[model samples]
Target: MRCHPLLPAWRAAARCLGALALLGAAVVARGQGVGAGVGGEAEIAAVGAQVQQLARDSAGRAGLRDARIEVEVGQLDPRLKLAPCQRIEPYLPPGLPVWGRTRIGLKCTQGPKPWNVTLPVTVHVYARSLVTQAALAAGTTLAPEHFTEAEVDLAAAPGLPIGQPGLAVGRTLARPLAAGSALRAADLKARQFFAAGETVRVVAGGPGWQVVTEAEAMNPGLEGQTVRVRTESGRLLQGRPVGDRQVEVML
Candidate 1:
């Protein structure tokens, strides 16, 4: 009897093939143990779009017009194994608030695993606002030539920008305003109607009887505000201003 010379070579080839099969099985088992996570560009877009739309829908209420909304989303945990989501809902977290920097919520539903997450968002409201063209003193009364209408990002600028030309026109600044500054309601004071020692018509009555008397204003006031006035008989009375120069009192 004699042994074939090729027998050893064939046996070695069989052993190599078995070893390769075992290595592949090990890789498959490890992959199954580690869960697959949802992430990357495509998934991010789907989630971000949902949040962006919610922002746009509420833009008008934020005083934003023709707004451009942009969003960025972070990746989920690599170890998470979320089932395929059929619906994704994004909204503001609880407080019904949206401003410069805010949070957006994401909820996934109609899937094997339902989950929620929060993302950071920045909102920019762009529109035409009245801003000072040059530095002006505290008492400087604003006019068309003093300021210019400029398109501004309201989120970055502190205080509300003057919305209309009529708002800033002929209005006295409450404090010194810098050049190219966004103007707010707090920046200016309304023109005074009743100044100290100024005589004003005071009408007091209701229903059927009316009495009109001339009195001196002890304190200056804006239209529709209360002012203390001194009458001819030395009576100090509080009255509600009904017009630009008139105050009314109920008897």
Candidate 2:
């Protein structure tokens, strides 16, 4: 075979290009594998700190005065072989709250082989709330002396804790409350506005008309709660309590 005049030069250029490509691939492989100084635990810790900062930012915006925020990050997957990242950046996860149980995203944005992950994060937002000051019997209505306001971890509460001292002032306890116990929504029920089987006035009209009738309460119910009532003519209906002895039904 006859060789062209520029064949030798072309061969040299191709060989140089092939060597450079091989070197580039080797460098990327080294980075993707277990690079000595890169530690998964370290990355996890960095991600955790970032999550805590983000949680604190949320507390400030929420106007929750004197709130204490604590963040806990879960362990990373051991089977994940993430490339050693130059910068492990943190970002907020969509549709998740930063105050309670949530998740945070961490990514290697500037690394040779970029990667990302979602880790479980828990934020304990503590704030002041009212709690029982002494053991109270069930059915005992709350008074000013029943509880006092104190700082408590809202995240750990069984239900939403009473924030204002007056919120517990007139509600009756569902069960006996222990001294110094947090006051959750499950702990109390609103006082019965009217006695069961008692005759009460119900307004049964809406926008255009007003019809007043009498009803007998089948069970005790609180204001704003639905109660079963028997009409004067023996018709059964459900209505919302409007006052101490008033029920209102939608037309």
Give lDDT per model, in order: 0.60, 0.63
Candidate 2, residue 16: how far the Cα is off, in Å: 53
Per-prediction backbone clash count: 0, 0
lDDT tens per residue, model 2, 113-189: 89876656565656667777888889888888877767666667445576666667777888887887778778877
For candidate 2, give the lDDT of residue 139.
89
Q: Please give the range of 10 consecutive residues that has the lowest summed lDDT in model 1.
A: 1-10
Per-model TM-score, in order, reads 0.49, 0.60
Off by over 4 Å in 2: 1-39, 77-118, 135-141, 203-213, 222-225, 232-236
Per-prediction CA RMSD (Å): 24.0, 20.4
User: Which digits, one per residue and each the tens of the lDDT, describe model 1 over residues 184-226?
Assistant: 7778876677677788899989899999998988888675467
Error of 1 at 233 (Å): 10
Q: Using TM-score, give the best candidate's number.
A: 2
